[model samples]
Target: MGNIVKERKSRPVNLDIKTIRFPITAIASIMHRVAGVITFVSIAILLWLLSLSLSSPSGFETASAIVDSFFVKFVLWGILTALAYHIVGGIRHLMQDIGYFEELETGAKSAQVAFALTGVLSVLAGILVW
Candidate 1:
């Protein structure tokens, strides 16, 4: 009976995941992992672009033309945004390592600050690039 009750308490979450509101630190941690993955995948695309640009003249022109297209530009901008957020969040985690935001409330507030700063920088980068 005790095991059954514990298992019931730990049941799978309902499909209403969107309605859940996570804390600031939780949001920051989640975004940090997501951005890391995005950056990893983005590196592949970037390498391909770099190789094409370094190849024959036709290949270089093709790479340049792809950059000029709105879709490619948008994808590049997205990668940049992810990179920026991941870097900033990583720094925040480093500070925590040195005992800066060890407190629960302070850590949560710092996370919110990081999240807000990421949004501002991402927007500025998008505007500057596209």
Candidate 2:
């Protein structure tokens, strides 16, 4: 155990992120985590908007006006995109847990499919937001 610890300590660590090339599955997994965080943070913004819209008649109009802005629309699109990606990634993970796409080739293909689905969803979300 001591020798193993010494050996591990002697190994060089690559801290340069740009130089690292992650596999497709790893990239998909990382993006899924990022999307989850975005979705979680977006809940606050969405709740605030909902509260504003429900507060009173004037508040509804104010919320509508705020949502009509280009920047707010863009932010909404981003939130939707993240939500879509997170859902797709979650499905992929569930499939994996069920003993599907456990092989290297199949896993990569699933990751690719997830990326494509996310792209399509993002485009649809952009259209909806705009």
Candidate 3:
């Protein structure tokens, strides 16, 4: 055990991200986590909008005006894009949990499909937002 520990401690470690190459599945998984975070943060903005719209009539008008701005529309588009990606990634995870796409090749293919679907959804979201 002592010798094993010493050998393990002596092994080389690569910590530079620039030198690292991530597989498609790994990238997909990382993006899924990022999208989840974006979605979580966007919830606060959405709730604020909901609250404003549900307030007095003037508040509703204010919310409507805010939503009509180019910046707000772009933000909405980003939120929708993140949500779409998160949902796609979530379905992939569910399929994996059910024993599908366990192999490396199949997992990569599933990630690719998720990415493609998210791309299409993002385009649609952009169109809808604009």
**TM-score for each predicted model, relative to the true structure:** 0.83, 0.87, 0.87
lDDT of 3 at 111: 100
Give me the displacement of residue 5 in model 2, in angstroms: 12
Per-residue lDDT of 1-130 in model 2, one digit per residue for the tens?
3555434457789999999999999999999999999999999999999999999999999999999999999999999999999999999999999999999999999999999999999999999999
Candidate 3 runs further than 4 Å off: 1-16
Query: Better model by lDDT, 1 or 3?
Result: 3
Question: To one decimal, what is the Cα RMSD in angstroms of model 2 from the true structure?
Answer: 3.2
Which residue pairs in candidate 3 collide?
A: none
Separate clash counts for every candidate: 0, 0, 0
For candidate 3, write residues 1-130 as lDDT tens digits: 3555434457789999899999999999999999999999999999999999999999999999999999999999999999999999999999999999999999999999999999999999999999
lDDT of each: 0.92, 0.97, 0.98
TM-score of 1: 0.83
Residue 115 alpha-carbon offset, candidate 3, angstroms: 0.4
Off by over 4 Å in 2: 1-17
